[model samples]
Target chain A: MTGVVSPMAAPAALRGAGAWKPAELLFWTLPVIGWFAFPENLPLLTQIAITALFALSLDLVLGVAGMVTLGHAAFFGVGAYAAGMLPAYLGIGDPLLGLVAAAAAAALAGALTSPLMLRGSGLSQLMVSVGINAMLYEAANKATEVTGGVDGLPGVENTPLFGMWSFDLYGRTAYVYAVVVLLLLFWMARRVVRSPFGVSLRGIRLNAARMPALGVPVNRRLAVVWTLAAAYAGVAGALLTQTTQFVSINVLGFDRSAEVLLILILGGAGHLYGALVGAVAYMSIHHLLADIDPEFWQFWIGLIFIVVVLFARDGALGAAARIRDLIRNLILGRGASR
Target chain B: MTILFDGIASGMLLFLISSGLSVTLGLMGIINLAHGAFAMLGGYVCVVALDRYGIPFPVAVLMATLSAAAAGVALERLVYRRLYGAGQLDQVLFSIGLIFVSMALARWLFGPQPQPIRLPGWLQGQVQLPWIEIGVYRAFLIVLGLVVAVTLHRAVGVTRFGARLRAAVDRPAVARGLGIDVDRVFVVAFAIGSALAGLGGAVGVELLGLDPSFPLRYLVYFLIVVVVGGSGSFEGSLVASVLIGIFDVAGKYYVPQVGSFIIYTVMVVMLIVRPQGLFGRPSP
Candidate 1:
């Protein structure tokens, strides 16, 4: 807790707390470049985007609000199921409409469960979250008629984007759709974290007891942010459902919860871009590792987790920043001598 | 009557496995999510010794317990010692990572299939009683569990080491000031806990089954035992484990439809209603 880099400490001039930085603008162009550079890997690219969004949702709660959870996948699964079921049960197949429905369903789930989170901290919080996730998973598993049980829900159909561009075999449309949604949500997340309300959330995270005396409604803020994060995760899950046109029990599994948390931490939590960077890095590594030995990829991921936690506490982004700072200092020293 | 008997036997097994977790989690304040993995290690050790090495059942079990305890000491010294002051998040991440690594390692060493375990002739078949007939193995479990429960109760409650452990748990700094080797106490307690888990895993193989996925499969059960019992309280865990074991068996037998849903729901409600657990002292 003491050594964690504050999310608010991002350079205002270079990273820009509220405004879009030039570097960020440059970062956004990579997807466009990827679209042209690697046409065959559109599906993988789309997965990275969706996962990034999921990691971003985690960052909102774990990194920004300081509510450590192992059950965030509950919201993701709720959203996925809601989206997948909409077309099956309600006959509403529009992608945008499904996203909206998914977000609302996840947000509702978050709001209902948020009170449980308010009960305690550390180990108790972890247990509560795990319990909630397990309960949902079991419920989903038993409701075979609806969820299709372990075999997964089939025939999950989604309408073409804006009723125009249909999801293609190569996942071209899905890629564009996923990237666009990720950008919009990432922008919204940035605004939310930069607002005065966001600052209070950070204050609560740093010192909950002191925040109450500062007139900050700690519990309410936690609830709101959690709900918002759930909505984001729901949207990401819906994207997966819409793009892949499938929903499985694995969506809500403990593995997903743990994987997303690892991805966020790997990218460097607290910072928005860390989610994006981590999703890309983790997914790429997973892709490579799975190709070699699908069964043992988790071994390497676990090893990476250990190494990162012990050596690189701030994650990839933090390490990159330190390197950049060192280079800048070297350049300044050279210029003064000249 | 059968359900109660079966439940109590299984509950005894749960107590053996989770008692160690209770001490480490409650006393050391470490959320060791990978505790089940150590139990799995013990189970594997027993299976390999019995099946491959032609070791007797009792000898195999002893080897399992000792090996797991040795592994625990090595890990604590090398990895866990560094994290004594880290945040719970770091601990969670590290332990989860450990789980993944161990699971993969187990899978590689033993195929994904459940390892075959053969009980000795003496431990086989059922024994008839006045009101009920119980499996010889289950009866053995109940007897072994009682022995452990009573022994542990005395060890923690009556021993000088137990006094030191309580002092360290209550006030680490003060305990150190009073010339107690807090670190050594923790290491010994941790090793003892791992040994119990190993013993539990080796013995419970018949009831719980054994596979590479053993750790994740039984993770929730062990956690429930510790949490419901109250983290650091030994007596509390014993009571909670039995309650849960009965509740789980009864839920499966009677409801048949709800499965473990009832157990998880109870745990959630317990956590919400009483975060300190049934017997745990409320945090300052």
Candidate 2:
């Protein structure tokens, strides 16, 4: 109850409330470039964009705030079911309003669950977070009248984007719409991560005990960030429902929670872009491996998790940094080793 | 009355499954998410023995327990040993990998179906009493659970090994200086924990049902028990299991609609009231 705190520190590159690097902007630009290059794979790219947004939301709490969450999909699932169900049941087809409502609903849910989570030790907090997720999932399972039980909720309708650019069969509208939201959120995430609030979050991640001594309201900050992260994830989920017009019980599953965690770890958390990078890699591998066998794909993902944990401390970003260092050392005389 | 019996019986099974994980986590400071995999392995072993071969239920149960404990020892040596002092995330990642691999193995070996279990005639019927109607298997489960609980309580609470193991976990350097083989204690404790989980699985198949998802499905139950009982306390696990078991059974029987939501709600409320669990002492 008292001292189950995480000891992970925010990496230096993300600690400063600073200006965006040119390279970071270029990183966001690459997806748009890919959109133009691969016209036939817009659907796949849309899915990736949505997933990257989900992972980015996770990075806020996990990497930036230092919370070890395992049930984030609760917010995501809640948002999806709400948005998807609303349009079908309540006759609200406007996608913009749906997105706002979904984010608010998820944020509300996150606020309710945060106090319970904040009271426990690290592991217990993890258990409680997961426990809430299970409860939400079970609720969805039983509320068959609305959720359609195990058969899944179908026939959610999305109105045209701002009265223009309707979704077509080729998925062009969906990809463009999703990417715009993603870029806006990604920009916001960058700003938040570089804000003074984000700097304090980094401090809390490193040492919550020390932060309270330094006049920071540690638990309050965590709760706020938790709620914020939940909203981000909710919007991401709404995006999925908005784009695909499908929401299944699987949305609230433990697998989704676990997969999102893996994506964050793979992309090398703490930075805003890690989620984007990791999602692209993870979803690509996921897409590629599903061609062979679905069950076995998880086996490879698991192996990737192991490798990332053991060798890549910061995940893909960490590995890329190491590779860059090696090449630099080869090119230069490895002066100062930095 | 019948509800109480079923709850206590189910709770006992949960305790047995999580007992190893609780003790090992307390003693080793590692979260073995793959613990349920061993339980599934036990169920598979028992099923293969009974279905593929003609082994008796009792013998198959014994074989399953031993084999599971043996697997625990091997994994502890080869895999888990390296993560003795590792971060929780690392431990989680590594054990999660084991889970995926075990799931694949189960599917490959068992062909993605719930393994069939045949109880003996004595265990297959019901015992109709004036006060309560009980399945013979439920009665036996209650008895077995009580016996295991008492035995484990004695082994961990009163025995010399228990005293040493406590010391080893609490103060490894001092315990080593005092001539305690910390490594040996960990290995033995881990083995016992795995064996108990296997025994639980072997006995629980008739009630809980076993499929490829068995490990992941029941994993939360085991975790709730270990966590709510206090990470390393057998007595705590026993109490939590009974409470959760009855709560779950009653919820299902009475509400039906809520099912596990009731249990999870209780978990949240309980955690809010006692974040360290009802019995868990705050760690330094």
TM-score of the first chain of model 2: 0.88
lDDT of 2 by residue, B127-148 (tens): 7899888888887887888888
TM-score of chain A of each: 0.89, 0.88
Q: lDDT (0-100) at residue A237 of candidate 1?
A: 92
| Worst ten in a row by lDDT for model 1 chain B | B22-31
Cα lDDT tens digits, model 1, A1-338, are: 12224445545532454666566777788899999999999999999999999999999999899899988899999999999999988999999999999999999999999999988888889999999999999989888899988998888888788889999999999999999999999998888788767777888888989988877779988989999999999999999999999999999998899889888877667777778888988898899999998989889988877766676664324453343334323432222110
In terms of docking quality, model 2 is medium
Docking class of predicted structure 1 = medium
Per-residue alpha-carbon lDDT of candidate 1 for residues B1-284, written as tens digits (9 for 90 to 100):
99999899889899989988987887678888889888999999999999998999999999999988998898888888778788888888888888889999999989799988999999999989888999999889988988988888888889999999889878989999999998899889889888888999999898899998888888888898888888788888888888998999999999877888988999999999888889988977
lDDT value for candidate 2? 0.82
